[model samples]
Target: MTGGHSGRQAYTGVPRWLYALAVLAALVVVLPLAAMVARVNWANFIPLVTSAPALAALGLSLRTAAASTALCIVLGVPLAVVLARGRFPLLGLLRSLVLLPLVLPPVVGGIALLYTFGRQGLLGSTLEVLGLQIAFSTAAVVLAQTFVALPFLVVSLEGALRTGGQRYEAVAATLGASPGTVFRRVTLPLVLPGLASGAVLSFARSLGEFGATLTFAGSLQGVTRTLPLEIYLQRETDPDAAVALSLVLVAVAVAVVALAYRRPGGRGPDGKAGKQASGERPTTAAAPGGALT
Candidate 1:
């Protein structure tokens, strides 16, 4: 049977103080956002958000976020696949290194990117010699976003892969399917929901990126300024417009996450298809021992 019924009972043993703490934690996050919403000038919300500069910033943010999300999928999928399936020395260290961006401060990441791609920097000098400039440009915005957002996709996809296991893949290989065929037809389909969720999260993160974009991309209107950058700039001049834009961003992020996670046909949070909804237990492949591997 599914844990939906049992899960409620399992939580009954929790101490009452834990619930109080949880509420306090929730309030800490919710109060600020509520206050920001309250500060928004509803009378001019539409005009504030639709101003020429606001429109340009919003458009650029969307474009760069989309591009960054695409780059994450393209580069992160292979990295996740290797991380999940490959066996190698120092693999754990490698995984930690790959995920470093997730924990590193955004400004530090921007500095790293600047050194790697800035003119007179590592690869930046080579590119400059070839008549290409990256730092302080729109491309830098996308790159900075991808640098910070890639780890989200990797972590999500890698976790999904680890949980889903490799039984189906092994079976496909035993049946004479080539590695490529099995990956395309079986592996990819199985992890698609996870990939979709990761992409949405990456997009949301990209939309909200600020420190790195400002540090590296240099917020030129209609060129590199994103919504977050716009909001930061507006905070100094027009707090009302800033509040309105912040609310817009918060709404979009909430909608994107909720829409992505809303599974159909009784699918559960685990991304299984209808099994949990039907009160069926999710399957797990056992290891050589009786316990889970």
Candidate 2:
């Protein structure tokens, strides 16, 4: 009666323990970040960042991450289209398998890659016949990064496909547009924001990949020592340098999240992608969806 009289019933119903748990979670994430920021010595921040080793790691990470992002795009786009548009048995299982890397321990993933693609492993003999080597090389770094980052791209694009729905694609088919043409013109353009966000998130994930690279690629300087690897190495020898490198990663992560969430084409915050170009009323996509009708 007291809560109703004061119009505070809603607030009263929220369990105090739940509020406490939320605060605890916030502190768990924030306190460590605050500590890292506090440890940063601004006086020599520029020097620490510009040091030769740091620069080499940064350059290598950027290179591998970019390559990995490209790989994710090439592979993820089609996979997303299939997953969204295809209605098959085990669809949910397939999605879970696609997203496994996101939840898998990075070390475990690295080990799996090592055994699956290692020189003495399953595909080793076949690769040797072709004069190709993957283990402990820059190629391996890119492979590892791609393995870990691909799920982000696929998940993002698939969600976009679902949200955009099959309505426009269906209409496009009705208009006599070839499947390829409709995909290129109507579907891709409509989901450009999803693609962009996915790419960015994939890039960020690749940039920070550490355990996989260390295990599969062996962390050679300028060859496989990504920024995160460098940060780990620096922590043992130089804590300040480690903090500086961490700051760079933290900054990059923030930028990536910002880019992914930003409104597309002057749309409001909630306007995920611009209105459907198909101009037909947007409808919830039914099962069996793809970019092409």
Candidate 3:
């Protein structure tokens, strides 16, 4: 195909009417954000967002989101690898259960957590005996966030693992690399981008978590109340503050998602940027052996 024709086909291959639908889809997302921005009280946006309650909620949200994302990475990576690479009975059932949070109501998850950790709950009494109270506390908030956000990381990394296949892994094993060495040198590197993207998505999901945190951990200023819960509370009393905080959340989420998709060295998918666009042929190195070494 001619370069210009190929470029045109890249975008126009879909049905002509789909372009209109695509525009409508974009509008559905953009219009609400536009209205929110328009409603923001620009005059007091700074003061409103900087208020003590707002700052506390934002700080709490950031801290819990970070903690939850770390937890998701530690736990979800292994789960994803198992789902994608391991063979066993009822594997499909296990995979579905792991991804349940993606579709389950946040409130239901919270209630389940509450029953597991609340006083008189299945494990709560046992925990209480050990003096480790969890429900209605900051730790509950982290658990709630992790419960809901874990699926995002798992889904992302599992898809990446499946897409990447086991070619490099097999090659590394053939070259005398141990399983751990192959994973560290071959599998992890191949899936690093997906893992990073998944972690960012998990952080974003945790940052916005509300129903689970509220139902399991009760909203308390500077404790379990995250920015979403703060926005909910402020909406009833001070819409201006709510709007300001919403904008802050939106901005942070946008920045994080942008960072997740950003390419190394700021190059586009076509690899056309800076001196690389000046006809320097990219070189490919030998795989497996060099990587295992």
Candidate 4:
């Protein structure tokens, strides 16, 4: 009995070497971020963060990220719904295409954007005719951010839509609710968590966006330079200031992830109405043929 019990314990246990390897992997990932944060001098941190260029970059990063995140939600949510529920030929191909940005290098994405929007680009002449220029401007920064960050939102929303099911929506439809009404009243609430998480991730990604923004918007102080741009520029001339800015960006990213993982009911201004609609179940109705309706 003792031998059997010992064998069972061994089978259920993780090896010490495995735990050590896991810890080492975590340290490898975390040590660089810790070093960046630890290098910030408290005495100079406030002045560095408040410097003119830093302040401007911070504001621009926030504004552009917010705008991009808003755009992602407006455009991505509908696409996510279609991808999750709608039936169409080549749908699998379309889904893979949507996720291309996530896998593409940002530098490559930036170059592609330049080719699509630069002076000699397909639409560039038309835009110039209308007195609009996208290249090397604040508008370009927002566009770059939106392009790179949109896939994150779409993937998250699609996962939520698939897992959350459409039963409640069907019930609402049976009760004579319009399609839009069913979406707003049933579907939206079920997927709010995923949307919120996706938006936060997109915002964080936009805040740290570099290669694409640099290529499309150019690094101009108080115009298109964001916090990440400021950090890169400072690294060549002022390492201390670079560290300070890096710390700030890291802090913001950490805060966003932390808030996203917090308990849903306990909230301070960020919680939405949909978070309260957690009790509904997926529909179990069937067609006359007895298969999934």
Q: For each candidate, what TM-score against the reference?
A: 0.88, 0.84, 0.88, 0.85
Which one is best on lDDT? 3
What is the C-alpha lDDT profile of model 4 across 209-269, one tens digit per residue? 9989998889989889999999999999999999998989988988987765566455322
* Candidate 4 TM-score, true structure as reference: 0.85
- Candidate 1 structure quality by residue, lDDT tens digits, 10-113: 34468999999999999999999999988989999999999999999999999999999999999999999999999999999989999998899999999999
Candidate 1 RMSD to the real structure: 5.9
- The residue pairs in collision within model 2 are 85-289, 85-290
lDDT of each: 0.86, 0.85, 0.87, 0.83
Model 1: how far is 98 from its true place, Å?
A: 1.1
Error of 1 at 247 (Å): 0.7
Could you tell which candidate, 1 or 3, scores higher by lDDT?
Answer: 3
| Model 1 ranges off by over 4 Å | 1-15, 274-293
